[model samples]
Target chain A: MLWLTFILAGLATTLPRASFIVLGGRVRLPPTLQRALRYAPAAALAAIVVPDVLVVAGDFAPLNPNLAGVSAAVAAALLSRNPWLPFIAGMVALHALRWLPGG
Target chain B: MPSASFRAGAREGFLAFLPLSVGLVPWAMVTGMAMVGAGFTPVQAMGMNFIVFAGTAQLGTLPLIVAGVPLWLIVVTALALNLRFVIFSAAIAPGFRGAALPMRWFAGHLLTDGVFACCLEKMLAVDDSRWRLGYYLAPSIWSWALWQVFTLIGVFAAGVIPKHWSLEFMATIALLMLLVPLARQRPMLVAAAAAGATAVVLRGMPLRLGLIVAIAVGIGAGFAAEHWQDKEEAP
Candidate 1:
């Protein structure tokens, strides 16, 4: 079942991406769904990021360096628009906080 | 002459995607390391990396897999995370109208955010279908190459590095780089904020079920905001 699930996952991913191309634009999605889908990445990433930073070992860890890292990353992303900048800033922040006294 | 044209198209595509490729490396390596740390065997991690070949989808599904969630949820989460690719497909569909079905399908499968942007930029100017296809292929190939190499390196290194280094944080930062810029629209901002709040609030849910719920609610929030905006603009 695990293997079958993986195959289905692949199909689910590839088919939606391939649908418009293979169908040669035959099927036009409704604008509503398309608009909603536009938010999918933001939602997905936010879901991942929130728990990753806030929840540590099944409890809220407000002081985690991950939170600081994410804040720095958000600023960098907003400022530069260069995708790498946030990552570098966040990584440096995360490590710096870890190395800092009482951080 | 045909091969020469293909080579030139490929070169154009490669250089076009080079900047984005530089950004792709750290994320890919983090993914590779995360896969192993999540208890997947090296072979399994690499297989998923190559076969799925999508960083976002793979990362989206990883936590669910690690938690022994139902297979259906795993598949659904990954697929849901990849829903944006449908837009990429539609946008790029007309350009490949003259190509063969199999080739078109192959191109669609290889699509990524960087490659899609680069391809769209060139599609307007280039009339030759073959050359256009070559342009798409070049970046796809290089991106895949870097992703594979870094992922493998991270997978091997996962064993050597102590968990104290907290390499997992790199994955989170990589995700932020992708996510932050995407919240440009009000609807998208609402979706992101809602998703973050839901995930953090429901962090107690078992098997990371809250993440899926958060995604669904986030999309709902975005959809609602858009509908509201449309109604406001209608009059």
Candidate 2:
């Protein structure tokens, strides 16, 4: 089942990416459809990230260490486009929270 | 003789991709480690990496699969996350029109965000078709090679890295950073926030169905924002 899942997953993932190359010569996508596709990455990433970071063990805890850490990271990301800063700030905040007494 | 233009194309592709390749290293490692930590065997993780070759889709599906989500849901989510690649394909298709069928197939498989961006920038600049193969191949080959090597290191080294290192947190932040650049517009930001809020509220849903719901809502919100903006501009 695991291997089958991966195989099917590969097919699902590859077909769309490959579609335009294979079929694009004959068919053209409209411009508006293309523009709307831009929102996908942000939406998809948010869907993956929010649950893992904000909801710990199936409950919302806005004041938790991870959330606090992510707050610091999000601030860094907004300030500078450098990709590494967010992760660094997040790690530093997470560890700092851990070091706090009774945290 | 293989054309001098092809050689030049290849050289340009490699040079252009060098900086992006450096940026990909840490992202690759995080993906690799995340896969191992998610409970995939080294072999399985590498297999997924080889076949899927997409970090975002792979990472997005991991938690769901870990929770034993239905296979169809996982597949749908992966496809949704990868929908942008279809746009990339449309954008780059014209460059490969003259290539043979099998070569075009290979190029399609090799198309990645970084490689596609590099190749498209170069393709648009030069009108000649003779160099397209080399230009496309160079970055694709380099990205695949580097991604495989780094992911392998992460999978094998997973055990040695302590859990307390909090690598999951690192992965989340990395993903968020990736999200930052993409959310340039108000609609995109609204989409992200709506998705996050939806995911948080629906986190208890079985098989991570909440994620699917969130993605739908977010995309709808973005679409609606665009629609409203269009309406406002209509005179």
Candidate 3:
């Protein structure tokens, strides 16, 4: 049953994943579809990362470093001329103060 | 397949996963604790390390399995949790156009967030073929191998790792590390910020459904920001 689960999981994951790559060259997606696809990497990432970052201890607590992380992310977002440097600087700032009160 | 390239890619992927262990070990250790709570033996939890590479799905499934949910539900949810991989594979496809099938499959399996971001950076930065692939493979393999091996150690020593050591905290840190080197634009920044905020605001939703809602909102925010910027760029 566990092996079967793995198989099911693998198929579910691999099919959708490989589908676009395998067929992208042959397919002629509309411009709207293409535009949506362009936003995918970031959108999917936001969907996954946001909830994890913000929630603390339980649902209704103070915002905490999760917001700080986002704020830091915004700072990095603004300082986009050299992407990696700002990204690292903001993250360092968060971790340094992550343990502080009222973050 | 060329022996050198095969070894090089696999080696790189494995090493890239190394530092992830420092973060994943605690999470997997918790998974170990969950497995025991759910009546799974430590070995079963350890075995799961090889079988399922996703952190969120592994943590999520523990409860469902414990509750005697159908196997189909657990597997389906895991797949859903990893739905972003579809976007990743799509974006990365163009880079592997002429690569061998086995090579491509290996790359796909190893495409975690860090590895993917690093590889994409390498791909976009370099015009040459040899070093571009090699540089990408270097950190990726390291990270992967570290994750799998430490995952096992976490299972074995689940009891020993300090409770307050903050494994999940470190994972977020590691995640932040990977993103730093990659966020080069307004849309990406807006998307991340909005997504994270949305996730927080929606935290009350059941079964982590709030997460799904937040992600959608964040993605929309990102897309809209990008479109607005494009309009501003028009002469």
Q: TM-score, chain A, per candidate?
A: 0.65, 0.71, 0.58
Model 1 docking category = medium
Error of 2 at B61 (Å): 5.7
Over 4 Å off, model 2 = A1-5, A78-83, B1-23, B34-44, B56-100, B111-140, B201-213, B223-235
- Model 1 misplaced regions, further than 4 Å: A1-9, A31-36, A58-63, A78-85, A99-102, B1-17, B38-44, B56-96, B113-136, B184-188, B198-235
Question: For residues B92-142, what per-residue lDDT tens digits would candidate 1 score against the true structure?
Answer: 676676788898888878887657745665763688877787788889888
Query: In TM-score terms, which candidate is top?
Result: 2
lDDT of 3 by residue, A1-103 (tens): 6656656655655565555445545554555544444445555556565556655676644456555655665566456644344345545665657666754
Compared with the true structure, all predictions reach lDDT values of 0.77, 0.77, 0.58
Docking band of candidate 2: medium
For model 1, what is the alpha-carbon lDDT of residue A58?
A: 78
